[model samples]
Target: MKYFAVFFFVFISNVFFAQEKENGTLVNGIIKDDTTGNLLSGVNIINVNTVKGAISDDKGVFHLQAFANDTLHISLLGYKSIKVKVTNDWIKNKTTTIQLTQKAYALEEVVIRPYVLTGYLEIDAKLIPTRENYRYSISGLKEGYEAGEYSPNAFGRVLGSIFNPADMLYNFFGKKPKELRRLKEMKKDDTVKNLLASKFDRETISALLGVSKSEIAEIMERCNYSESFVKTANDLQIMDAISACYEEYKILKR
Candidate 1:
């Protein structure tokens, strides 16, 4: 009788553990931008009161296991974060799409002034003393972009590439007149941001902007630049933009 009772208890424990491991309680979802309806990759999702968490992949999909009453917190840069209560009913339904709204920058009471590089330098000299480090960082970022490394931050990478001063001059004077013209059209017509948003990563952006990276990839997709003039010009513009940002940072610091 004693042996039989012990055997029964062991069997029940095994069944309970198995059910916990392979139960109907699973949370799966996708994160996307509310305005554009584009999937947002690299968004972080965490359980608010627990250490459990996951990150959205390239396809913006995430899967996590939870019990009936767990709360999930979702966050991404440039967008407002959201918290959702997970119940048994929620888990049973599965397959959720969480929409994140974009946060608008408040422009009220803010003064708009023309961007003057020299004036920026004079002000920076008082603020940040480590100006040389900033320059070195930007220079390194330019080099990484030219070498075809993807940035980690999407916004930072696009800004770094588009605002590079050396690249602008090179395109103006280089051989690929047609390509340079296309770039100009993209810039003037305001399509550059969209193009980069669709393609760049945070690491790629950080590399382009002289910021730190959480993860780095060994390879990046090469830009389609067949014309020598276009290629040279684009490269120069990217490098120059990074330099310019660094220069401004130095000036502000001083």
Candidate 2:
């Protein structure tokens, strides 16, 4: 009877300790540039198992709750990514400092030439001429005229394309002066909306907005971005789009 009592107590204590260990602990850390020794802001720190994450503050500090043995992925733009384990010792230390190496890239060499030819006939605006074919631009234009090679129709069409009359008409429709300006603004807005949709997935949107997957659709729909607009904006521009759309979402909630 005595032996069984001790065995039962030991088993129960072990189970309780295991359960406590699984609950995880909060981890605090600072991220720095490996070489420069400067704090890195906006660094993404994510738990490999739970997907829970946090971004470093201006001081390059982050705190995240994670399992004791979970791996933390740390990443930032222009820096090499790294992973750290949330071991028992790390937790006991309360906070740790990690440095990330910068990713270096070798750029290709480039050669620059004159912008305009003095009298080159073979080369057009497209730069499609062969390397061996070269001449002065003034001489080329003079010869073209002497040979009666100039076509008014083609030249007129090219000039018209450069100075589009439709663009003038566009402003005329919108109170004359502001019509073109308004159209440009509308185009920019559409570009922003499409940029957000393309760069961010449903999960990413949820993470940013602090919303669930089901709520993302309605929020995105309210953004009013066209599919074509997304193809126009680049990565950096897309961040501005995300901020604008998030503000729009907040407005809708109000």
Top model by TM-score, which number? Answer: 2
lDDT of 1 by residue, 63-94 (tens): 87676776676767788767677776667788
| Residue-by-residue lDDT tens digits, candidate 2, 1-254 | 99999999999999877865775677899999989999999887766455566778999999887777877767676787677888888888879999999989889999897666646656554564432221212211233111101322422332332345453211222222322222223234332233333443343333333345454333222333333323333332333433444333334334
lDDT of 1 at 128: 54
lDDT score of model 2? 0.52
Model 2 lDDT-worst window of ten? 140-149
Best by lDDT: 2
**Model 1 per-residue lDDT at 169:** 26
Which ten residues in a row are the worst by lDDT in model 1?
215-224
Give me the runs in candidate 2 sitting further than 4 Å from their true place: 1-23, 109-254
Q: Give me the displacement of residue 33 in model 1, in angstroms.
A: 1.4
